[model samples]
Target: MSPRRRRTEEFTSYYGRPILKEPTWEALDIAGYIFAGGLAGASSILAAGAQHTGRPRLERAAKLTAITAISASVAALVHDLGRPERFLNMLRVAKPTSPMSVGSWILSVYGPLAGASAAADVLGIFPRAGKAAGIGAGIAGSAVATYTAVLVSDTAVPTWHDAHAVMPFVFAGSAAASAGGIGAALSPLAEAGPARRMAIGGAAVETAMSFAMERSGRLSAETFHQGRAGTLLRLSKALTVGGAVGIALGGRSSRAVSAVGGLAVAAGSALLRFGIFEAGRASTLDPKYVVVPQRERLAARQEEPAKADTMG
Candidate 1:
């Protein structure tokens, strides 16, 4: 392949611009990601709460959120594809190296299982089935929440590659925090202990991961640390801190505080994805990141051949 084509493949994007210039999407995509995160995160919080207390409210919230999360995951995915017909094409290959592919498969499993659990809850029939569905939803929702970290990490960009190991936890935390924020706003303050804890914990995790992703120096680390990403990083820290504090202070039922905190965590999570997307593109734009890493691989591959020939 020509150097230009090769560079494009490694870097990402149609050209120098972002794939979604305005980041505009159908309502489904927008709501789906949020719902998915909320569902999974909320489900986790409820599950945790269930361990301590068996309030019917918490259980109801968890079941509803998990189902909603799964539904949104599916909707967001379909919207992401831009065409209902293109869905199956995504599964043509199971490339371990491809984050999008891996994420798709994960979401596919998480979506249906979680939705079924919620559906069971909606219907009064089959108490046994509802329990089974809830378990399935919990498992699937958690996966949907965490795997996004790997999705970002799987990219060839400097910022993402360097922080691969930590991103999953970060995503998981952010998702949970988002759920907690929502629950706190809607649920009674006294009963919101689980939600508050989850939100605060999630915020902390996201803040740390965002810092780590920015601090790494592989290639586009600067990209993440300057300009838009820099702004985002600072914003994430502020929001996470603010949100965590707000949740921990026992005032979550306040509409204003909860709204701000929820928006903050959600923004942080979304920006994380956006920043990574841009950073990957930037890393690929320059020939050095691609050439440098691949060259090292080739060199390592060549050493084995040379050593074998020498021995022979």
Candidate 2:
């Protein structure tokens, strides 16, 4: 084939321009990794605050949860990479242009510290200074969670990119709530106050951000309110409310309540990721999402004569 024809045959953007594919189910799972790390980090912060306030149980709960969640987050990330060997390749050529590439480096740095801090606590090694590790790890973990929002938002996916302004807060809120629910399940009520409080705050933020995202763009919002995306939004709202109420009532004191509620928030967050990913794919599948806006822009441009032509 001629060079021009060869180049023409290659896949490109939705509109025959160069752009990445919409996120897949695998990508959704990777997004969950981000959600988990964020929750883990937020939990650590809450626990640290509890520790400073003389709440040993909350502190321990936070420390343990951050470690466990971060580990899970890393596991999901590796699982998404399709191979462990290729994971480090992310760092080999730090591409600021690619969000996933940057996120890989962030996770790599944060994952180990989170595991080590948790291990130190579990083994009682450096128990005296393990608190320091918890603080550090938790902060890094939070960054892991929130930064993914930026990663997804920076993409060309209409649903993901259009929701850029509110996506981070939504992810952060969901993460905080998930960790708090876990803490409530594992820690005593008195010490779990911080976690419970976080749950409420997170639920509110997630809900608000989601609403804002829907309002920000019609196409993006359609993904959430239609079909499976609608189902996720519905489930997320129900679970978020239930979890918040459970936390407020000090459900942590009850294992069943804690277990059920925590799982709800965690599941809800994962669903949100899937919903977002699917929506991006759906947006790409229909030319309306891609062409409508571009057509409007062209028509507007055509109506406006060039400066030189208009002046003549």
Task: Specify the highest-TM-score model's number.
Answer: 2
lDDT of 1 by residue, 1-312 (tens): 866346546664345444322333443464346446544645644543542475556566666766665566666767777786676787777877776787677666766665565566567667677666566656656666777667656654555666787767666766777776666555555566676676777778777766665665454466676666567567667766876786566355575676566556555555555555555555544555555556667888989989999999
Prediction 1 TM-score vs. true: 0.72
lDDT of 2 by residue, 139-245 (tens): 67677768888987887677787788888988888777777777766777556667666777777787788778877745446777877777777787788777776
lDDT of each: 0.62, 0.71
RMSD of each: 6.6, 7.0
CA deviation > 4 Å runs, candidate 2: 1-28, 95-97, 249-262, 300-312
Q: TM-score of predicted model 2?
A: 0.82
| Candidate 1 local lDDT, residue 125 | 64
Off by over 4 Å in 1: 1-52, 89-102, 252-260, 291-312
Model 2, position 252, has a per-residue lDDT of 49
For candidate 1, the per-residue lDDT at 134 reads: 64
Model 1's lDDT to the true fold? 0.62
